[model samples]
Target: MIVHSFPPIIDSGCRMLVLGSMPGAASLQAHRYYWNPRNYMWRILYALFGDGREPDEAYEERLAFALRSGVALWDTIASCERKGSLDSEIRQAIPNDIPGLLADYPNVRAIVCNGSKSLAELTKHFGDHPEVRSRELIRMPSTSPIPTRDYRGLEDRLEVWKKLLEL
Candidate 1:
């Protein structure tokens, strides 16, 4: 099993936090969120921001934009054991200290789970907490390539995410 190395990166100005189940191989290797070419995160954000921007922009640039726009990216699990990079194969999942992270970033008001796995883990672990109960839970499509086998394109998957930006 590979060791989970990165700590969550959150913005003090983040009004919304997007949580995924765990990082995939590309992300872990790049030490950045959505590092895989197939990951739709960058594309979706570029669509939200406007076209002239290429999805190939630097990772820091993308992260800076999200931080400036009050959006934070992280994962639900602090650590987990998996033989491979697939989120679907993650075993011995342990929910991270989300409340502590939220407390550190006081501006966060809504929590958006990247998919059902994250939502399920969050609910399973912290659903009873007062802060968790108060936060808005958004269930959006997973950006992992694994999910696309059963779903449509990123544009279709990101429809709910666009609506989320309105909030």
Candidate 2:
């Protein structure tokens, strides 16, 4: 199946850009980023930036909160063929115009890749671009529900992701 990424949830004030590989099945079905309840992206963001409360259920509210927090969201892959939500399944990936976006939004000081795939794709496609090299590039653990030996729980992942607060 061919899946496409959403438009960037970005603004002029954004200082941080979070890039995922692409929207997964649940997110695509719901027309939102990290729509899967088990996904820790929202939870981690709220834990770090919110007032010690659960993230708002409304996607609009979440986007607003992220923007207000000086963060933006997007995907490394503009479109790809994938059998499932796993990044490993992706093929024929066409990258988004990351350099163009960065050129337009110069305020962004850091680029956070949500997982290995996102980082790999970004490096493959845009590593040499001046816009990308100018900013701090970060590779974060995937916020997907799937567990890994290193990041098997929210607390574990949250600890590593807390570095975003420092940026």
Candidate achieving the largest lDDT:
2
Error of 2 at 7 (Å): 0.3
What tens-digit string does per-residue lDDT give for candidate 1 at 1-167?
Answer: 85473677676778898898888877888888888888887777777754536764677788887777677888888788886677668888887889888878777889999888889889999988877777887888887666565567776776766877677
* Candidate 2 per-residue lDDT over residues 37-119, each given as its tens digit: 99999999999899668999788999999999899999999999998788999999999999999999999999999999999
Q: After best superposition, candidate 2 residue 76: deviation in angstroms? A: 0.2
Q: Estimate the Cα RMSD of every predicted model relative to the unseen true structure.
A: 1.8, 0.7
CA lDDT of each candidate? Answer: 0.79, 0.94
Cα distance off (Å), candidate 1, residue 106: 2.1
In model 1, what are the clashing residue pairs, if there are any?
A: none
RMSD of 1: 1.8
What TM-score do all the candidates reach, one by one? 0.90, 0.98
Highest TM-score scorer: 2
